[model samples]
Target: MNENDKQPDGSGGPGGNPWMKSLLVWVCILLGLALFVTVLGGPSATATGNTVPYSTFLDKVNEGTVKDVTISREQIAGTLSSGEKFRTVPIADPTLVPTLREKGVTIAAQPAEGGSIWVALLYQSLPLLLFLGIAFFVIRQMQKNSGSGAMGFGKSRAKMLTQKEGRVTFADVAGIDEAREELEEIVDFLKDPTKFARLGGKIPKGALLVGSPGTGKTLLARAIAGEAGVPFFTISGSDFVEMFVGVGASRVRDMFEQAKKSAPCIVFIDEIDAVGRHRGAGLGNGNDEREQTLNQLLVEMDGFDANEGIIIIAATNRPDVLDPALLRPGRFDRRVTVPLPDIEGRLKILEVHMKKVPVAPDVDARTIARGTPGMAGADLANLVNEAALMAARLGKRLVSMAQFELAKDRVIMGTEWKSLVMTDDEKRMTAYHEAGHAVVRVHTPASDPIHKATIIPRGGALGMVVSMPERDNYSYHRDKMFADLATVMGGRVAEELIFGHEKVSSGASGDIKQATKLARAMVTQWGMSEKLGMLMYEEQQGETFLGYSQTQRHNISNETALAIDSEIRALVDGGYDKAKQVLSDNIEHLHRVAKALLEFETLTGDEIKRLVAGEDIDRDAPGAAATTVPVSGTSIPKTRRPKGPFGSPAPQGA
Candidate 1:
C-alpha cells in the first residue's frame, strides 16, 4: 500500500466511529425537549373553576341563578346569572334535560359544531397547524438553496456573463502587452475554430494565468470573453468544495457539462489553488472532498477532445501548490505571466486612467510613470482615483500635478496625521532625523538621489526621507548597498551627535532594524565578507534579521558562528561611523534645512534641494510658502506642498 494511504484520524478503526458521539447527543436533546413540553407545561384557559357534584349543580339550577347551559356527549358547561361560566360532568339521567327546560333556564345540546368538545379541539389544532406551516417553509427554502434537496450539494454555481455584463474588451486592459497578445490568439481561435482545424491543428484547451494579486488576471479573462463575444462562465475555486463528499466532483462535472452545451464558450475558474492543491494533504482523517473535486476536474479536462470549442482558463497566485497533473502539456497548453508593470508599462496604464478624468496642462502621465515603479495595474488605478479626489476637495478646476503628488504620498504611506499635536522639541528632533538621511544620501555617490524630506508625522513614523531613482532600477552594486546602509544609520547618528547618546529617542528603532538587516545580508547572502568566501553558511530560506539563523543543525563550527557574528557587527559599526563623519562635516547645511522645515512645517523636494544649495527665497512674497490642507483626514490642512522630482510632490510637515 502507498505510505500516504494510511487511514485518516477518527476514521472508525479500533476507537469506533466519531459520528456515534454526535448521534447520541442529538438523541439526548430530543428526549429533553419532549419531557419539557409534556411535564413542565403550564395551565390551559379552559381549566378554570373547581368541579361540583351533579346534585349541587341541580340545586344551583333550581335556585334560578343559572343563565345558560351548554351540553355535550359527556359534559355540561353553563353560565350563571352573575355571568360566571362553569363546567361539570354530565350524569346518566333522562330527567336532567327535562328538568332544565321546566325551569326558567335556557339550555343547549349540540353536536361537534358548537359544543365544548369542538371548541377545545379547534384551539388545540391551531398551534399544531402553525408549527407545521413554519416547518414546511423552512424545508422549502433549504431545498431551493441546496440543489433540489439535501443531496444536491454538487450542483453547478457558475454564473454566465453575456456581452453586456461589464463588457471589457482588449482595449480596456493595459500594462501587459505580451500577455494580451497571447490571449488574443485564443480569441482568434474562438472566433473561427475552423481556421485552425482545417489546417490539421488543434485549438489550445486551456491557458493558465499566473501572477501576484491585482496584476490583472480576472480582467484579462474578461477581455478574452469580450473579444470572442461568447458566453463567459465564472466560478471560484471554493465554490466546488462542500461538507458532503463527492459534491465538488459532481459540481465539476455539471460545470463542464453546461459549458459544453454552449460549445464555443470560455470557462474561467479564479484562484483554482483552493481545490487543485496536492491530494491527501489535509486535516481530514478519511477521503477528502477537495481531492475528489480535483480528480474530477482533471478527468473533465482530459475527457474533452481537441478543437471541441470549450476552453478552460484558471488563475492562481500560488502555482507552487497546484498538482502537476493539471499542468501537463495537453491540459494547460499555455502559461502566461502577469507581473507588476515597469516604467513604460506604468505610463500606459496611467494614460488609460488619465483619459477618464479631467487633467490640467501640466499633468504628464509619462513623468508620473517614471516616478512610480513596482506598482501593479490596480495600484495605478487607485492612485488616479485618489488624485482626482484630492483635486475635487481642493476645489481645483482640473487634476494638477500637486494633487497627484499628495495622492502618491497617501498611497505609499497612510493618510496624513497632522492633528497629532507635538512639542517643539519633538518636531526639531524629527527635522534633524530626516535631514541626516538626506545629507548622507546626497554626499554618497553610490546612493540613490534624495527625492524628498519631511518632519511631518505620517503613517507611524515622525518623519520620512524618500529616495527615488531616475528610472526603474533592476540591479544594485555592492557599493550602493553600503551607501544604503549608511543612509539608514545616519538618522540615529544625527540624534546621538546632537542630543547626546543618552537623550536619543527610540524613534530610531525602525532605522536600526533596516540597517542591521542590510549589513547581515552583505555578510551572509551577498558573500561580501572576504573571510566567509563564496560559500553560504545559512539555510535555503534566509533570515529576516541580521545574524539570525534558521537551521536545525549547526552547519558551521562554534568558532565560525562567532566569526559570522563579528562580521555583521563590523559592517553595521563601520556604516555608523561613516554616517557620523558626514553629518559632522555637513552640520551647517543640515541646520539650514531643519530651520526651513521648522518655519514652514513642510518642504517639497525642489524646495529642499534649493534650501540645501543655499538659494535665497522671497520669504515675504504672496503664497511663497502656502501649504495645502489635508481635506478629509479629520485634520484640516494648514498647508499643502507641491509635487517633487518623484512622481508626487515632496512632503514636508503638511
Candidate 2:
C-alpha cells in the first residue's frame, strides 16, 4: 500500500479503500466487546461453592460425609452427604485413593477446558496489541506532519490555493494598475498560449514584484492566477531553508516536480530575499544551506529542462539583497514595481474599501486621498475600516465624514493622549509654539500650506502644526528644504521671543532635532549647499550583516568631514535666523493665533488666517465670513512641496 493512503487516525485517506477502513473499525469493536465479556464473566464462572480447608475436606472424606469427589491439578471439589458442595486445595497422599475407595466415595477427574486456554491467551496479548496499534498511529501522524509520508524531510511546503469562493481577480485589485498590466500578459498566455505563440513570443518564465511592504504585490500575483483560472501555489522563501544540509535543495526539486504535474500554474514565493541573497556576500563563504537552496532554485527555474507552462512570481521589498544569477533574463524576465498609490489610485482604493461598509454621503474619497499622500493600498483599506470602527464605537448607523477625519488624524498623528493632563502654563506655552509654526508656514514663500494647528497632546508631541501639499512632488527643491528648516525652527524662535531667551523651555527639542536632520540631509545628501557643491558628501552604505558593517570604505578625508559638518551647522543657523526674523516681525499676529488655539484647542488653516486679519470666528456656524490677509513683505508663491501625513516627523514641540 502507498504511504499516502494511510491517515493519522488509522483510517483510510482519500485514495485508500473505504471497505478496508470499515472492516478495521468493526474488528476493533468486536475485540472490545469480547474483552469486556471475558473480564466481567471470568470471576463469576467458578464462584458457585463454598471454599473449605484441606483438613476439613479430608476429615469429611474419611467420615464418608463426602459423596462424590472431583479432583483437578490444584484443587478438589466434592458433594457432601448433606447435598452441599465445597472445594479446597488438597495435599498429596499415597493412600488417598485407597481411603476414598474404602469410604465408597465416587471419584472423578476434572480436566482443563480448551476455551479457557484461548481466553487466557487473548487476555495476555490484548495489551501488547493495543500498544502496537498506538505506536503505529503516532508514527503515521509524524509522517503526515513532516509533509511527505515516506519522503519525510524533503517535501515542498507550498500550499495550493484553490479559490472556490471570494476569489480575487483584477477587478478586486486597486492602486497598482501598472503592476496589474505587466502581469496581465502572463494571464493571457496561461489562458491561451497559441495567441502569443503565433507571434513567436514565449511566456515570461518569472516576474519579480518589487515594492515597499503593504504595497499589494502578493495580491497582484493572486489576481493573475484568478484571471487565468489556473492552479495557484504559494510559499515563503524561508520554507525552503532548514537546519539540515541538502534538505532545501531536495525540497526545491520536489516543488518543481509538483508544479510540473499541475502545468500552467502560478507559484508565488513571498519575500524571496530570505533565500535569494547574494552568494558569498557574508563572512567566511556565506551560508552553505541557503546558497545551495538558491542554486537549486535557479536551476529549476530556467536550467537544462524547459518548464513550459509554469510561471514563477516572487515578491520582495529588499530586491537589492537578492542574487543576480536568480534575477537573470530567463529566470525573472520582468521586474514590476508596485509603488505607493497616487491621489487617484488612493481614491479608487478608498472607494473599493468603502463599498464594504455603509458610508454616509458626506464622506468624500478624494478628500481623504488628498490628505493621505504616501499611503499604500493596505493603508487606505485600514483607514476606511478605522472610520467604520469609529462610527460603530459611537453607536452610529453610518460612517460619516467626521469619523473619517478623526480616523485619519489617529492614523497619521497617533492617537490623541487624552489621559495626559497639562498645567495652564504648559498649555499656554504649547499654544504659542504651534502658533509660531503656523505663522512661519503662512509667511514663507516656498513652504507648504498649513492645514491645522493643535495644542492637544498626540504621540510624543505636546503640540503640532500640520502642513499639506497642494499636489504630489517627487523631487525636493533647495528653496523648499530651506523653507522646511525655517519652519521647524519656528517653535524655538517663538518661545524665545514670547517667554524671553532665558525662559525658553525644552519643548523645542523635537523641533531642533527635526531641523538638524533636514539641514544635514540638504548639505550632505541632497547637495543643496553652495559650499558643498552638487556632489554627494556622504556615501550610501550597504546593509549591515550580523551587527557589523558589510562595506566600510570611507574615501573622504578628516578635513572634508569637518567641512561638511560646518556647512550643515551654517544651514541650521541660517534657518534659525530666518525664523527669528519672521516671528519677530509678526509678533502680534502670532499672539492672536496662539490665543485662538488656547480657546479652540484646534484650528484650521483658514481660521488661522482669519485670526491674523482680526476677524471673529463663529464657532457654531460653518463658513463664517472672514477677510483675507494680504502678503506685505515676502512674495508667497503658490509652489507645491511634497510633505507626508503630519509632515513626516511633523513640526511639533516635544
Candidate 3:
C-alpha cells in the first residue's frame, strides 16, 4: 500500500474505524435470523383470537357453548362450541375453573412454557445492549474528532509522504548554500550507505535547524528526502503534546517506530520548540505533557543508532529555549543555523523563484537583490509572487521591472493609501520633510543613496524617502551611525524649518522616536560616546530559558545613568543640528526639490541627485507627473518646478 494512503494501525483500518466491521456484523446477524426462520418454518401455528365481552364469555362457558379454553394470568382465551377462538379479560375468581367445569365445557389451562426464561432474559437485556451500543458509538465519534479513540491519545499525527507525493527536491530550494552542504551529506548517506560505512563513518542521528520564520528550514528537509528517494514523515511538535498526559510520549514512540520501518527516511518536526523548550522553566515544576513528550523524544533519539539510516530533522526559531539534553551529541548531533540570505544569496533565490514566472527581459534580479537587504529566502519568493500578481492585475503579459519595483516598495513600506486626501499645506510640508531626508542622505557621506522620495501616502506615513544601499553591509561604522541618526532627524527638522515649531504636524513623532532610540543605542550599546568609555551597559537582560529578551538589570550607578541620558540627548541634538545646517547651506536647492516634488509627487534617487547638483529637471510632457525613473534606468520627463508655494520658485538666480 502507498505510504500516504495508510494511517497507523490503531488509528485507522477495521480495528480503528469500525463502520465496515459493524456493517458486516449486522449482515451476519440478519443472515442468521433468515436461516433460523427457514429451518424452523416460521412461528408455529399461533392461535388467533377475537376479543369478546367478559360476561358473554362466561355465559358461553356456562351454556356449554365453549369447546376448549386456555387460561393465563390476566385473560381467558379459548375456542367456543362453534370452533371460533375468543378472548376476554375475566375477573380473578377462585370459582372460575369450577364453574367452567360444571357447565360441561371442555377447558384446558395454559401449560408451562418452554424456553420462556431465556426469552424473558433476552427481552430484558435488549434495551441495555442498545444503550451500550449508542454510548460506545458516541464515545468513538468523540475520540475520532479529538484525534484519539478510547485511551488512544498516543497516536502519531505525522503525515507520511509517498514517492509520488510532495516531490520537492534540491532544485526547488535555493540560497543558503552552507545549509545545503551540510544536508547533502545526509542525502548521500541515505542513497548509498555502503560508501560511508566502508570509511567507518556514521551519519548524524538527527540535525536541528535553527532560524527565524520563513527561512526555509522545513523546505530544506523535504529536499533532502527527495534527493535521497526516501519516504518523508512530517509532524509538528504540538502533535506530540496532546491534552491527555503521556500522550505526547506515546506519540513520540509511535513516530519513531514508523520511521524505523521506513529506513533511509527523513523525519521532520517543524516548530519543535513547542515541545522541546527548556523543561522546568515555565510556571511551577513543569512536569506536564510537553515535558513528558520531550523526555520520550530524548529517549527515542538515544535509542536510535546513527547507522540505522533513519535520520531525524527538526526546525525551531526558538532554539535558545530548547533543552540541552535534547541537543546533546547522541541526539541532535548537528546544529544548522539557517540565517537570512545575503545579497548574493537573495539574488540566487530570486532567480530560482522567477523560473516559473514569465519575467520581462528588463527585470534584473541582481538589482532587486541589492535594494532588498537582510531579506530571507521566503521573503524573496513572496516578493517574486507579489510582483507577478501586480503585473497580472495590470493585465500585462509578463511580470516587469515596474511591477517588481512597486512590489518591493509595497513589501517594504506596506500597501499605499491612495484614497487619503491631504490639504495643499500638508502636501507641501510632507514634500519638504521627505526632501530634507533626501538632502541629508545625498550630502551625508556615509548614508545610502536616496532611492525614491515621494509624497505618496503609504501605510501610516504621508511621505517616504527610500535609500538604496549600494551593497549588503555586514557592519556599521561610526560615520554610518552618525549619518543614519541625522537622516532620521532630518524629517522633523525640515518640518520645523518649513512650518514653525508651533505649526509642525505630529507626523514627525515617529521620526523623533526613531532618532532618540538610535542615539540611546549609540551611547549605551555601541559605547560611541566620547565621555563614556568603551563599555556595554545592559539596558535589558534577556532570559535564555524563557526565550524572551526583557529584564532590566542596572549595571551602572544612578550618577552614571544621568550621564548616559545626558550623552544620548547630546547625540540627538548634535545630529539634528548637523542636519539643519546642511539644509540651511542648501536652502535654495531644498526648495527646488520640494517644488519639483509638488509638481511630480515623486522623485527618483537620480533625479534627487541631479536636483541637488542644480541640474535642469523639467519634463515638457503632460502625463509625466505620477511616474519616476528606475534607479539605474533612463529618466522619464520631469515637469518644471511649480511656481506656486515652496517660496516662489527658489528665488530664481539668487
Candidate 4:
C-alpha cells in the first residue's frame, strides 16, 4: 500500500494479519484429521462388480490404501455400514484394495461425489465471522469518539477564525471617527509591548467598546488584531455557559489557555452582558451558570498582567445593565465610546464606501450626509449599497443623484405605495399641510433654517419639511426649544386653518411624540419649566460613566408628577397658540408660499426667504443683527438668518 493508505499514527495497519499468521497450523490439523478418518475405516479402491464381504474390507482398510471405490452396505458389512455410497479416493497407497467396512461397519454400492462438506463450511464461515468481528470493533471506537453520541446537548457556539481568512483593519471601518482614534492606540500597545514596559507603563488589561447596536464595536476589535498582526480568538459571552455545572468555568479556562499559548493575541467576547449581567438579578434558576462564567472571567483578567501581551476586548450596547465588578478600573481599564456620527462624519463614511461604486458627479456625499441625521456607519453603508442597486435596476451606467434620492426615500420610508391611489383633493391637502410647516418655519425667527419642503409622501408621511441647523448646536436654549415645538405643531395647525377642521390623519404621530417628549423633558428633566423650579426630576447619565453608580433620583409624590404634566401641556399649548396666530396674520403670504410649495416640491432656505419677502413684511430694524450660537467643532461661517420685510429682526429665538 502507498503512504496515503497508512494510518495517521503510523501503525503497521489493522490486526487482521494476526489471524492470517495462524493459517498454517489450522491447515495442517485439517489434513491430519482427514488422514485419520481414512485409516480407521476405509473403502476398496476398485469399483466392485460384486459386493465385498464386511470382514474382508476391514482387513484391507488396516493397510490404509484406498483409491476410488464404491460399495453396497449388504456387500460390505464388517468394516463400515453405508446406505448411501461414497467414492473413495486415494488415501496413501493405490495398490491396496481397502476393505469396504471393518469394525462392525457395512457399505452399499452407489454413485458418488468426492469432497468433505465440513471443509467447505469452515472456509465460508471463517471469513464471515472475521468480517463481523471487524465491524463490531469499528462501532465501539465511533461510540467512544462521539462521547456516546451525546455531542448534540452541549456544543460550544463560538466561531473560529484562522490565518486563512484575513483579519479586519481600522481602515475597513468608516464614519466612526472618534471611536477609531480611541482604538488606534490599543493596536500600537499590542504590537510593541516593550515601548511601554521599558518605561514602567502598563498596557490596559481590558477595553470595553460600548455603543448602540451595529455601531461597529466588534469590527473595531477585529481591526485591533489585524493591525497588530496577531492571532485572534472570538467567542460570545454566551458561549462560555453550558447545561452542566462547571462547564462554563472550564470553557473560560480553556479560552484563556489558548490565548496564552498564542501570546500577543486578542480575545474578543461580544455581547458580554449576556453572562456579565448583575448577579442574582434573573428570575428563577437565576443565572447561576452565567455567574460562574463571570467569576472565572474575573479571575482570568486578574491573573494576566500587561507583560503577557494578551489583551481582552468586549462589546455591549446595553451598558446600563452590566455588573459594576466587570467594568471596574482594574478589569476594563479603558472604555471606548462609539456614538452616532454627525454630518461631516457621515460624509467621510460615504466617501469610503463610495470608492468601489460607480457614482455620477452630481451625487453629493455631503448633501446625503446632512439628510441622514442620526444614521450609524452600518446604515450609511446600506444606503450606498441601496443606491447602487437602484441604479442597476434603471439600467444606468452609474448611480446618479436621482437614484440616491430614491434610495434615501426607500430607506427612510417604506417602498412607494404607488397603488394606494389618493384623490386630487387629498393630494392638495397634503401640499397645503406641508406648506404650512415651511411657511411658518421660514417666517418664524426661532426655527432653524429650512433646508427643503416636499409634499411627496415618504416614510408614511403625507409630506415632510426638512430643517437643518446652520451649524451644529450642543445646547438648546429655552427659546429654541419652544420654537422647535411651534414648527412641529405648524403642519397640523396649517391643516386645520385651510381644510376647516376636517378629519385629520395620524400622519403627525411621530412629530407629536417627539414634541411631547421634549416638552415633558423641559419641565421634568432639564428644569426648563419656570413653575416647577430648577430641580431635575429625570436623571441624565453620561454614556461612558454608566453602571458605576445608582443614578436614580429620589421619587417625588404623584401630586408633583401631575403638576409637572400640567406645566408641560400648558407650555406646548402656548407655543401652538403663538404659531397659529403667526400663520393666521400672514394668511396672504401663506397662500402664495403653499402654492409655490405645491408647484415645486422642494425649496431652499434662500428660495423660501425670497418667496416670503413678497414686498409685504418689514425687512429692517435696529438690533436686528442675527445672533450666532457657537456650534462647537465648527469653523464655517454661519448663514445669515431671515429677517422681516422692514429689516426688523425676525421673531427668531423668540
Candidate 5:
C-alpha cells in the first residue's frame, strides 16, 4: 500500500477512538439477554397466558417425550392435548413457554385481547435508549478529554505533520545547507534500515532542531518526513498540555505508541520546550503540571522499551530553557542548528522562490541577495512575492529589477504613508534636507556611491537618498563609519545653509537615532574614542535577547557610562557641525539641487554630481548636468570628505 493509504483513522491511529467505549456497553447488553434466556428455560418455549406451564412439564417428562398440559390465566383457560389431560394449574414462570413447545405439547389458544404491554414497551424503546445513552456518554467523554475547552496543563503543544500530508522535500526546502545535510542522513537511515542495523548502530530516539524562528527548522523536519516516506505525526509542545493533571503525560504515551506502530516513521514536535522546559525553573509551585509532563517525556524517550524504528524530531527556538534530561545522550542524541541564511544561501533561496515568479530579464537574484544582508529564508521569500505584487500593481507583465528594489525598500522601511499632509514650506525644507544628504554622500570619499535620490515622501520621510554597496561587504572600516555619520547630518546642514536658521522639521529623527547608536558604540563598545584611548568600555557581548545581555561589562561603571554617553553625543554634534560647515561653503550648489528636486521630484546620482560641480541640474538650463560632454569616460575625481566623517569603526568594528 502507498503511504497515503496508511493514514491512521484520524483519532490518529488504527485503533479507533473512544467509540470502543460504546461498543463495550453494547456487548454487555447482549450478554445479559443471553444469560436470562439460559436460566429461564429452553429456546423453543413461548409464554401462555402470562404463566409458564413448562415447569411442571419439565419436572415430569424426559427430554424426548410429547406431553399434555393445561394452562390457565386470570379469566381464561387453555388446554394442550397429547393423549392425556389434567386440571388447569397456572404457574408464574412465563419464560417456560419455549420449553413446553420443545416437549411437543399442543396447547389451545384463547382469543387475544391485548399484547403483553411491558414487553411491547421494551421492544419499542431499547434502540432509542441505547442511542441516547451512547451519544450522552460520548459528549461527556469528549468534554473531559478536551478539559472543558481548556487544554490540559500537562499536554505537549507540538504540531503533527504526517509524511503523506506534508509534501516538503529537500528541493522544497531552501537555504540552511548545514542543517539540511545533517537531517538528510536521518532520512537515509530511515529509508535503508539495515545499513545502520548491520553496524549495530542504535537509532537516536530524537533529534532536536534548535534555531531562531523563521530560520526553517520546522521546514527541515517536514522535509525529513517527506524523504522518509513514512507516517509523520506533528504536534506542538503546547498542544500536549492542559489545565488538568496527567493529560500531557497521557498524550506522550499515546504519541509514542502511535509512532511505534507506524515504525520507520517521523514524529515532529514543534516548539517542544512548551512542555519540556526545565523543572523547578518556574514559580516552583510543587503542583506545577508541566514538570510532570517533562518527567514523563524523559521516561518515554529513554525508557527501557527501545523506540525501535520510530525517530522523534522536535524543534525549539528557546533551547536554553529545555530540560537537561530531554537533551541527554539517549534522548535527543543530536541537535541540528538552522541558522539564518548567509549571502550564498540567500542567493540560493532567491533562486528557489524566483522559479514561481515571472521576472523581467533585468531582475537578478544575485543583485537582490547582495542587497539583503542578514535576511532569513522567510524574509527572502516575502521579498520575491512582494516584487511580483508590485509589478502587478504597475500593470507590468513581469517583475523587473526596479520592482525588486522598490519592494526591498517597502520591506525595510514600512510602505509609504502618502496621505500625511505637509505644508509647501515643510516640503521645500524637506527637499533641501534630502539634497543635503545627497550632496554629502556624493562628495564623501568613503561613502558607497548614491544609486538614487527622491524628494517624494516615503515611509514618513519627506525625502531620501539611497546609496547601496557595489558588492557584498562583510566588514566596514573606520572611514566608512565617519562618512555614514556625515551623510546623516547632511540634511540638517542643508537646511541651515539654504534657510539660514529657519526651523527645520524633525525629519532626521530616525537618522539621529541610527547615528547616535553608531557613535556610542564607537566610544563604549569599539573603544575608537581618542580620549578613551583604545580601552573597551563595554565588552563585545553578542546574541542577547532584544537588548538584554547576560555578559556584564566589568570596566563600565556609572561614571564611565555617563562619560560614554557624553562622548557619543559630542561625536554626533561634531559630525553635524562639520556637515553644516560643508553646506555653508556650498549654499549655492545646495539651492540648485533643492530647486531641481522641487521641480522634478527625483534625480539620479550622476545628475546631482554635475550640479554639485557647478553645472545646471535643470534639463532646460544651458549646459544641463544631463547634457553629455564629449571626453574620456572618466575625469579628474574630486577630493571629497568622507560621508560619516568619524562615524565608522564603532558600529562594525566588532
Candidate 6:
C-alpha cells in the first residue's frame, strides 16, 4: 500500500474484512451471556461466606453464635447469630449432624452445581476475545474507508449498466452522423458476429471515440450497446488508479477477468486520457502507478491472451496525449472522430430535443441551428431546456420563438445581467460601441451579416453586436479574417471617435484583447502575414506536470520573434484603420443605428438596416417591410426579414 492507503487513524474500515463482522457477532453473544449469568445466577451466589476450620465451626455452634446452616456434599456453610457468614469442610464423623441438632441450629442440604470450573474459565477469556474483536473491527473500518483493504484493493470498480427503460439506441442520437454510422457497424457486428467472421474479419478489438467534450461520444458508445442489446460495463479511467503502486494494475487485471467471463460485452471507459497519457512524456522517471495500469490495460486489450468477444469503446477529448501503444491497430482498431455538428446536424439535434418540449409554431429549428454554428448536441439540448424554462417563467403554455431567441441569447452570450445598472453616459457609449460594430460589419463586403446589436448588459459585456453566417463555414479565407479583425476593432474605434482617446473607458479592453489574439493567430498560426511567409513560428504547448512546462524550447531566433510581433501589430493596426475608415464613411448610419439601439436596447439585423435607411420600425408588425440600406457608396440589396422565431439572421461569427 502507498501513502494514499493510509488513514488518519491507521485502521481499516468495518466492511474491509469479512471475518470482522463475525467477530462482532461473537462479541455481542459473549456480552449477552455474561449479562445473563450475572443477572439470573447472581442472587443465589450473593451470600459469600468466609472459610473456617471444622473445629472453629464446632466452637461457633457450641457458643450458639451460628444462626442456620446449609450443607453440600463436600462443604458446610452457616450464618452466625451476628449475621456473619462462614463455610467449612465436613468431617468423616457421623456425630457432626447430631451435634448441630443439639445446638438447635437449622440445617439444609442441596446438590452441588456442575460446570462451575468451565464457566470460570470462559469468564477469564471473554475480555481477551472482546479486545481482539474490537481491534479487527477497527482495522476493517479503516480499510473500507481508504478503499484499499487487503482483499478489496484489487477489485475492479466497473459498473455494469442495466439501462432498461431509458436505454438509448442509435435512433435517439443525432448530429455527427459520421461517428454514428461508424458505431452502428460495431453494433451490427456485435449483434451478429458470424456476419463479419465469415468474411475473415474479427470484430475490431476496440473503437476509439475521439471528439470535443459534449459532442456525444459517450452517448454514441451507449447507443452501440443498446442497439446490440449486449452487456455494458462502464468505468472511468481514474477508477483503476490509486495512491497504491500496484492497485491500478491489479484492478485492470481484475476488470479484464470480469469482462472475459461476460464475453460479447462492451466496456466503455470515459476519459481514458486520465490513465492512457503518453508514457514517459511527463517529468520524473515516468514509471508511475498510472503507467503501470496503462501497461496492464494494453496487455489485456491485445496481449498473448486474446479477448475474443469483447469490444472496448473508450472516449476522450484529448486523444493527442494518449500513449501510442494503447492506440495501436490491434488495440484500438478504429479511431472515430466525432466533430462538432454542422448546420444540418444541428437542425436534426434541435428537432430531436424540441420533440420533448411543447414548442409553438413560431419556433423554426433551421434558423436556430443556423444561428448556433459551433454548438454541440448537449448545448442544443440545454438551449431547448432553457427555452422551455423561460416560457414557463413567462406563464406560457408552449415554448415560443421569442423564448427560444432569448434562450439562444442566454446560451451564447450568457444570462442577461438585468441587475447591472448603467448611467446614461455609459449606456449611450455602449450603444454607440455596438452600433459601430454593426455599421462596419454591414458595410464590409467580406464580413458576415449582422444578426443583432444590443446595449443591454449580458455576461461581461455592456453590449454586443452579434453576426450570423449565411451557412456553416468550415474554414476562413484571408479576406474574411481581415473583415473579422476590422469588425472587432469597431468597438474601440467608436469609443475613441465618440469620446476623445484620453476619455475612452476601459469598456473596450475585451475588444482590444480579442483583436490582439486574432491578429497574433493570423500572423503566427494562420500564416496570413506576407512578411512571415507562411512559416509557422508559435510552439504548441500541451499538458504539463504540476502546472510547470517540461521544456521551454524556443525554435525561433530573437529576430524572428520580433518579426512575428511586428507582423501582429501591423495586422491589428490595419484592422483598426479599416474599421475607422468604414465607421467614418458611414458616420450618419452609425449614429442612426446607435440612437435606435439606445431607444430599443436591442435591434435585429433587419431593424438595424431599416434604421440605417431612416425608416420608422413598426414594433407591432410581425414581418417588417424590406429596405435597401446604403453602405460605403453602395446600396445593400433589399432583403426581406426572415419569418418565424429568430427575427434576425443566424449568428455566424463570434
Highest lDDT among the candidates is held by which one? 2
Whole-structure CA lDDT of model 1: 0.75
Per-residue accuracy of model 1 over 536-609 as CA lDDT, tens digit each: 76533322236333433247789887888899898888888999999899888788877876776655556666
How would you order the candidates by lDDT, starting with the best? Answer: 2, 6, 3, 1, 5, 4
TM-score of every model?
Answer: 0.78, 0.84, 0.81, 0.69, 0.68, 0.80
Question: What's model 4's TM-score?
Answer: 0.69
lDDT of 1 at 570: 87
Q: What is the lDDT of residue 34 in candidate 1?
A: 55
For residue 553, what is the lDDT in candidate 3? 39
Regions more than 4 Å wrong, model 4? 1-167, 304-307, 502-506, 540-554, 596-610, 613-654
Alpha carbon lDDT at 212, candidate 5: 68
Instruction: List per-candidate RMSD values in Å.
Output: 11.6, 6.4, 7.9, 13.2, 12.7, 9.1
Residues 247-360, model 2: lDDT tens digits: 899999988998999998989999999999999899776788999999999999998998889999999988989999988999999999999888888889999899999999
Q: CA lDDT of each candidate? A: 0.75, 0.80, 0.75, 0.66, 0.69, 0.78
lDDT tens digits, residues 209-248, model 4?
A: 9997767888888888778878888888877767677778
Which candidate ranks first by TM-score, i.e. highest? 2
Judging by TM-score, tell me the better candidate of 2 and 3: 2
Q: What is the lDDT of candidate 4?
A: 0.66
Return the clash pairs for model 2, or none.
none
After aligning candidate 6 to the native by TM-score, how far in Å is the CA of 456 from where it should be?
1.9
Clashes of each: 16, 0, 2, 37, 48, 17
What's the C-alpha lDDT at position 646 in model 6? 16
Ranking by TM-score: 2, 3, 6, 1, 4, 5
Candidate 5 residue-wise lDDT, 495-577, digit = tens: 66667766766766657766886786688667678877787666544345763434446655788777777889888987787
